[model samples]
Target: MTPRRRRMVLVALIVLGVGSAAAFALTAFQDNLLYFYSPSDVTAGKAPTDRVFRVGGMVPEGSFSRASGSLEAHFILTDYAHEVKVSYTGVLPDLFREGQGVIARGRMGADGVFVAEEVLAKHDENYMPPEVAKTLKKQHEKPTNSGPLPTT
Candidate 1:
């Protein structure tokens, strides 16, 4: 082949290689991406069923329970408007407790439960994960009273 033709073919091959690599990297990134959702979002069917994602909310009082002889625990996560049941079969974080903000990472199970691979709790009494705080804020901002305010 002529030198010019050989050079053109090489350039085309290099471009193809780079394009293929980019596409592969993008696919990997997308597959590994984890999204955050509130319990309300999960209850509304907005969470992905086939991919790992995060659910954050308050663990309601009396909603947490541990198995008799196992590390497995079940709890309900709620954003005041909705709730999602979560199951985690491992030691929970030191700060994990009912009536506190928590976030769990996992995928939804066949039984509509969140099978958590990792569970995180708030760092302190005054601290809450940003996602959880945002969800709670949205929940509390909804007007509960439709009637106009009355003055004394």
Candidate 2:
């Protein structure tokens, strides 16, 4: 082959290799991505029933309970509009408590309860996960009587 033709072939091969690598990386990342959902989403059947995902909301008052002789515990996570029952079989975080923001990672059982593999509690009263905050803001916002708010 001519020298210029050989150089062109090499460049095409390099581009193909880089494109394939990028596509593979993106597929792997998407496979491992975990999404956060609120109780309202779960109730609306937006959460996956077969794969693990996160559920975030407030641990409502009078919703936490522990079995007497086991690590099993139960609680209700609520977004005010809906609630989900969560069961966990491990020690909870020190900061976990009723009326606090929490995120639990797990899958939903056939009976519609969330079986948590891990539970994370907010570090402070004023702090909430950004996803949870955004969801709550959207849920609580009132429509303006005059007109829609101006977009920036």
Candidate 3:
């Protein structure tokens, strides 16, 4: 084959290889990406049920429970406006408690429960996860009283 033809073929192959690699990388990224959602989002059916994702919120007071003779725990995570039930079958963090910021990574179960593989709690007294903070803030910012305006 002529040198020019060989060079052209080589360039075409290089381009094809690069394109394939890019596509592969993108696909992997998409598959592995974990999205963060609030309890409100989950209750609204905005979270993906097929993939693992994160749900962040405050564990409401008196909503935590443990199974008898097991490490399994169940809690309700709420942004104050909505709540999602989370089940974790492991030891919880030292700082985990009711009315504190927590983030659970897992997928939604068939029974509408979030089956958490990992549960994370705020590390310090003043340090809430940014996502949890944002979610809480968003919830509080919502208008609770959407009433008709009064006129003079």
Top candidate by lDDT: 1
Instruction: Give per-residue CA lDDT, model 2, range 33-152, as digits (tens).
Output: 998999999999999997899999889899999978889999999888789999999999999999988999999999999999999998987899887787778777845477776899
What lDDT would each prediction earn against the true structure? 0.96, 0.92, 0.94
Per-residue lDDT of 1-152 in model 1, one digit per residue for the tens? 99999999999999999999999999999988999999999999999999899999999999999969899999999999999999999999998989999999999999999999999998977999999999999999998867988889
RMSD to true structure for each model, in Å: 1.6, 6.1, 2.3
Residue 4 lDDT (model 2): 100
Q: How many backbone clashes does candidate 1 have?
A: 0
- Model 2 stretches with alpha carbons more than 4 Å out: 142-152
Any residue pairs clashing in model 2, and if so which? none
Q: What is the descending lDDT order?
A: 1, 3, 2
Model 1: residue 97 alpha-carbon error in angstroms: 0.8
TM match of model 1 to true structure: 0.92
For each candidate, give its TM-score against the true structure. 0.92, 0.85, 0.93
Native-vs-model 3 lDDT? Answer: 0.94
In terms of lDDT, the poorest run of 10 residues in model 3 is: 137-146
